[model samples]
Target: MIELRNVSKRFADLVVLDGVDFSVRKGETVALLGPSGVGKSVLLKHINGLIHPDKGEVWVDGQNLTRLKRKELARLRSRIGYVFQYGALFDSMTVEDNIKLGITDEASAADETYSRKRALQCLELVNLDPVVAEKYPAELSGGMKKRVGIARAIAGQPTYLLWDEPTSGLDPVNADIIDSLVEKLDDELGVTSVVVTHDVRGAFRVADRIAMLMDGRIRAMGSPAELRASTDAAVQEFLERDLTIPVHH
Candidate 1:
């Protein structure tokens, strides 16, 4: 489980997250929804201790992230997987090498045979052919690179997964494919997940619950049907605008 208690953050003078409270239960997928640059990604980073809140605590799996020592935090982080928005694959490294970097265990990573086998297995988990493991990042299309990023994140078989805009730059067809992949992964891996996305249709399809962030706070959060029936004007406005986009299937 992950919990943030009255979290707040600011950059220079601009406040991003203000008095925000959020939590994710074990074995459930929650979608963090908001417009671009609304600090959804920042909030996600706090779960892994990448960003610290000014006046609140972030607790994960019965441990407070802010109080954990460096080594202790690293140990906890090994149980979490983060998929960056831009894919973040090294242009210089082959796909296999990138995936191997996620093998966090020192002993397992040192074993050449294990690393190789795990990389191939991760590729398969993301529905990519093992042949693609030998290709460079530049050789693959946008969707393929995103899959490689997800494959890399799951290489360690983490208990928790954080995805930042997994389908942001893709076309609608590819976006739907990625959404389906997100659902497949959650069911197959049984990993708790937080997916930050502006895509309403994707969130509705994939998340067990949805939380909408606006004006540095969670304006509303509930199931898809509940959100659709929300009385809050902000939630209605945001949903009306995003839902205008044609949702294929």
Candidate 2:
């Protein structure tokens, strides 16, 4: 459902992505793995047209993101939900209102009754209580805020979900919680998902396939078991570093 062909992006002298080619199939969850300062997040933005690449093309659900008109891009984005790195909740709005903003369907967003019900349902789907919807972001714990962010992302009933560092900044316990939630949601919602994260354990636990980005290119990619059995130096180095296994080479 998503494809990136020869995509390249650079900021002045710093090249983030170089001839990157990536794809995620329908109903499959793919994790983009890379170290800090790589272009994992930048690549995610390209799928939804949030950031345009300097070269190459990005296709999502059959539409070329680079060629889409502004209105058309917006329409396409409505079917895809994005969960930002740090929740990015509006502090001024209640949790329910924050999630309500995710409702892109004009009629549903306009219907106060439907929005309220949808927000509550989304919160439940994220394992949050309905009472939390009445609270503000400031009132939530870090993990709770992340769950709320997820609730907001799914509030629109999107066909695709893009998560940018969903487990970042959380404690190990919270990170595991988020990982399990990602797995559960993928099974329940059956939405095509692309998760951008540096956490190898979480990626292994949640993704159907993992793609490692290094030196502005996809260095290695495969299922968790396949990656573990890989002999590539760069791939082995990364796996050993994150998994704490000894690297012979």
Candidate 3:
């Protein structure tokens, strides 16, 4: 389980997360939904210990992230896979090599044969053709690059997956593909996942539960149906503006 209790953070005079409380159950997917710049990404970072909170605790698998040592944190991080907002693929590396870099274990990463197999396996998991392995990032389309990013993230076979705007820069059709991929992954891998996205449609389709962040706090959170029926003014306004009349799966 991943839990954040009254977590708070700030940069100089700007407050990002203020007394935020969040949690993700094991083997479940949760979507952190909010408008851009509402600290959605910041909250995601807290899960992986990329950013430490100023107050409170971040617990993952019963271990406190903020209290862990550097090496301990590194060890814990290997169990978590983080997919960045942008497809942060290395331009100079082949798709196979890029995915190989995600092999967090030193011994496995050094074994050339295993790395190659794992890379191909991850590509297949992301619905990519094996032929794409030899190609560089420049050769693939935006959606393919995003898939490659996810492939790299899952190369290590992490216990938890944290996605930051996985479908951010795609057309509706491609975005739908990624959303479906998310669903497929959940059923196939059963890894705990936290998807940070502003897209309500995609979130509703992929997440088992949705948490809306507003004013540096979780304003509302529940299943898609529960959020849709929310009476909160802010929640209603956001859905009204960001979504069409009826939200369908």
Candidate 4:
């Protein structure tokens, strides 16, 4: 499980999170939702030690992340897969290379054959043809790129997965496909997932639990049903419906 206690982060005069306390149990999918600049992304960085809080600590499965040294932190990160907003695939590498990226340090070991098989299996899980493995990132469509990224993330069978905007620019059908893929990864692979996204504001198709961040704090957090019932002005405003509202207005 992942746990945070009394965590607070600040950048000079600006505080992104304040006295935040939360825990994500094993195999749970938690969606981090908030308006732009609320630090939902910052929190995800904290989970992986990418950014550390000025105060408080982060623990994953009993390992104290904030206190870990540089090399230790790198090792820890290898066990957790992070999918950036744009898939962040290496432009020069083929789909196969991307998937095998996670197995880098160990690729020279005796287990290389098994690792290759595992990487290919991950591609199959994402419903991509194994032949695409030989193609470069530029050769695949956006969805294919994202799937390849996912394949790489799970190449080492990470225990935790962090997805940053998994469905930002995709169409509804593709977005839904990504959502199901996330659910499937967690359920079938038994990995803990934390998704940071702003898309939920428009679709309401978020994760099992949603935490709304505002003013450097988690203003409200609970199941979708619970957030829907919230009367808090900020929470209500975010989930507001204005289909008739003009974009220019």
Candidate 5:
């Protein structure tokens, strides 16, 4: 499980996360939902020890990330998988090579045949043709590239998966496809997932529970129906995308 206790962050003059608390349980899928600048991505970073909080703690599986040194952080990070918004793949490398990057040595490099076969199997999980394994990222469509990225993220079979805006740049159909795939990963593989998304509709469809952030704090955390029926104006405004009503600064 992942836990954040009174975590806070600031960017020089601006405070991004202020005394925020949220957690992702084992086998649970939690969506961080909020406006674009509410530090949703920052919260995701804390889970993987990408960024330490200014104060308080981020604990994953009983390990307090802030207490860990750099080397320990690396070990903690290796257990987690991440899929970024842009599906950052090496344009020069083939899809197979990209996924192979995640594979640990001795397992992946046991022999040339073993490595290639494992990489291909990971690609198959994302529903990509084995033929495309040799293709470069530039050759794949946006959705395919995203799938390949997901394939790569799971190549090492991480216990925790963090998705940073999975459906950001895809069409509705493709976005839904990705959403289904995420749900499949959790259900089939039992991988714990924490997805940070500004897309409310997408979040509702994919998330087991949603945590809404505003003013650098978690304003609400509940199931989709619970969040929709919330009495808080902030929650209502965020779900409704109320641009006309100005929130106090």
Candidate 6:
């Protein structure tokens, strides 16, 4: 399980997270929804210890992240795979090599045969052709690049998956494909997942539960239907805005 108890963070005078309490149970997918710059990404970082909280505690699999030593934190992070918003692929590396970088287990990573097999497996899991392994990021389309990023994140067989805007730049069709992939991976792998995104439709489709973050706190959280039925004005407003209703004069 991942738990944040009254977690708070600040950059200079800007408060990003304020007294936030959130959790993701094992083998469940939870979506953290919010508008741009509302600290959704910041909250995700707290899970892996990328950014420390100024207050409260971050617990993952029963370990307190804030108190872990550097090596301990590194070890913990290996069990949690993070997929960045933009794919963050290395321009110079082939898709295979990029995925291989995610293998944190030294002995397994050192074995070329094991690494090769693992990379191919991860590619297949992400619905990418094995032949695409030799291509660089520049050669792949936007959606393909995102898949490669996901493949890299899962190369190490993580117990938890954290996705940051997985469908950010994709068209509606492509976004749906990615959302389906997310659901497929969760069902097949049974890994705990936390998806940070502003796409309400995608979140509703992919997440088992949705948490809305606004104004440095979780405004509301529940199942997709529960969120839709929410009486909170902010929640309703966000949902309406993202649904993109035709504005009539």
Highest-lDDT candidate: 6
> Could you give candidate 1's per-residue lDDT for residues 104-153 as a string of tens digits?
99899999999999999999888899999999999999999999999999
TM-score of each: 0.96, 0.96, 0.96, 0.89, 0.92, 0.96
Clashing pairs in 5: none
- Per residue, candidate 6 scores C-alpha lDDT tens digits across 144-201 of 9999999999999899999999999899899989998998998898899999999888
Using alpha carbons, what is the TM-score of model 5?
0.92
CA shift of 98, model 5, Å: 0.8
How does candidate 2 score on lDDT? 0.93
> Model 2 clash pairs?
none
Query: 1-249 in candidate 4: lDDT tens per residue?
Result: 888888899999998899888778888788888877888888889999989999999998789999999998888888799888788999998888788886635653237687678778989988899999889999988888888888888887789999888888888787778877887787898888888888764324536677888888788888777877899987888766522342210
**What lDDT score belongs to each candidate, Candidate 1 first?**
0.93, 0.93, 0.93, 0.81, 0.86, 0.94
Arrange candidates, best lDDT first. Answer: 6, 1, 3, 2, 5, 4
Higher-lDDT candidate among 2 and 6? Answer: 6
CA deviation > 4 Å runs, candidate 6: 243-249
Per-model clash counts, in order, read: 0, 0, 0, 0, 0, 0
lDDT of 2 by residue, 28-142 (tens): 9999998988989999999999899999999999999999998999999999999999999999999999999999999999999999999999999988999999999999998
Please write out the lDDT profile of model 5 over residues 1-249, one tens digit for every residue. Answer: 999999999999999999999998898999999988789999998899888899989999789999998888877777788898889998889898898886654455556787788789888888889999989999899999889989888887788999999988899899888988888887888988999998787788778899999999999999877887899987887788632333221
Q: Whose TM-score is higher: candidate 4's or candidate 5's?
A: 5
Off by over 4 Å in 3: none
Candidate 3 lDDT tens digits, 1-249: 999999999989989999999999999999999999999999999999999999989999999999999999999999999998788999999999999999999999999999999999999999999999999999999999999999998988899999999999899999989998888987798899999999988888888899999989999999988998999998988877767856575
